[model samples]
Target: MLTKKSLIGLTALGALALNAVPAMAQVTAGSQEVHAYVGETFGDDLTDRRISGRTPELDDDVTYGLRYGYNFTDAWGLELSLGQTNSAVTGLPGRDIDLDLTTFDVDAVYHFNPSGRFVPYVVAGLGYASADLDRPIIGAVNGGSVRIGDDNGFTANAGVGAKYFVTDKVSLRLDARYRYLDKVVDRFDDSLNTFETTFGVGFHF
Candidate 1:
């Protein structure tokens, strides 16, 4: 029997599959490519100990990463990527904290316009992440500061993106993704979901 979370994940994937069918018709057999890129990651509002029905938020910041992929067919490709972000913690009163996040993922992508100048794709992946929260300023008496221990867990992400090929070997890529994290950290019992958008240039070989 499929659980609630499993059902939701499948539904989202099905929608993307439908959109990629038309694009599959245009793909050439045995087409392969490799790419490298850099981008930013943004985390969503996180709830630690809820205070008066409110949750604290983490500030969004720049992130950089690289990706490598191979296309077995025009519509189907596999991608592995790594990225990291250092973001300051906000919304906590009288606290100075910084959170560092790292991600490694393997995704399957479906390109909708593989032969055209503009190619649109949807990607879904399983990822591993490590998160660390540290106090930036040292103080003997930090007032009620919420301290989160370093932890790691599994994650899943889904996103839509586009690539515009400038030449046979170069392209501009733009992506927007939503990442759902399990065990956001060791302390938090619930999951964390974040949104990230990035722009980068890719080189294919």
Candidate 2:
């Protein structure tokens, strides 16, 4: 026969064991999820120009946008992002140009360790970019109006990022990426390239 004290102790132990089973199940279920993030991108422009005797310069600018991703497996996922960047040009007198660049991209990401609190990933993607260039240029030979057309092109991007999970539902992220853009034609042939670094927060569901 069980004594009163022994009965109470056994009952408490059984209750504790029963509670622990759900906690373990929760941990296993938390590893696989879909997440969405919104963040701002801050970095220098890595604009490369292949024009002879001309160098490309990019102004400091910031872009803000949203990203949505879906995890297919424990370690692989795909993400799509949309954002815009504004660039200004200097060094050429009366040739200061402000460009608006909009981007849409989809990438495949491989997470290093999805079960860990801190996860790192590498990503590569193909995308399209559209740029509208606005600037004033003074004619060298004869003073005349030379309006430059809007420049649009296809772009490609690749990058790596690390995320720190604050909880099962939230994380902090940092990323660095390189983008190559198509050519732009004006009084001078110009093209834009970019190296972007972004830091932001994410939510998992």
Question: Which residue ranges in model 1 land beyond 4 Å of their true spot?
Answer: 1-38, 51-54, 136-147
Per-residue lDDT of candidate 2, residues 61-175 (tens digit): 6654567777777678878887666656543435667867688888887888777866888988988777666754333323433333455567778889987666555566778
Tell me model 2's lDDT, rounded to 2 decimals. 0.59
Best by TM-score: 1
In model 2, where do residues sit more than 4 Å from their true spots?
Answer: 1-56, 135-147, 184-191
Score each candidate by Cα lDDT. 0.67, 0.59
Lowest lDDT block of 10, candidate 2: 21-30
lDDT of 1 by residue, 46-66 (tens): 554553334555667766567
TM-score, candidate 2, is 0.68
Error of 1 at 119 (Å): 0.9
Give the Cα error of residue 57 in candidate 2, in Å: 3.1
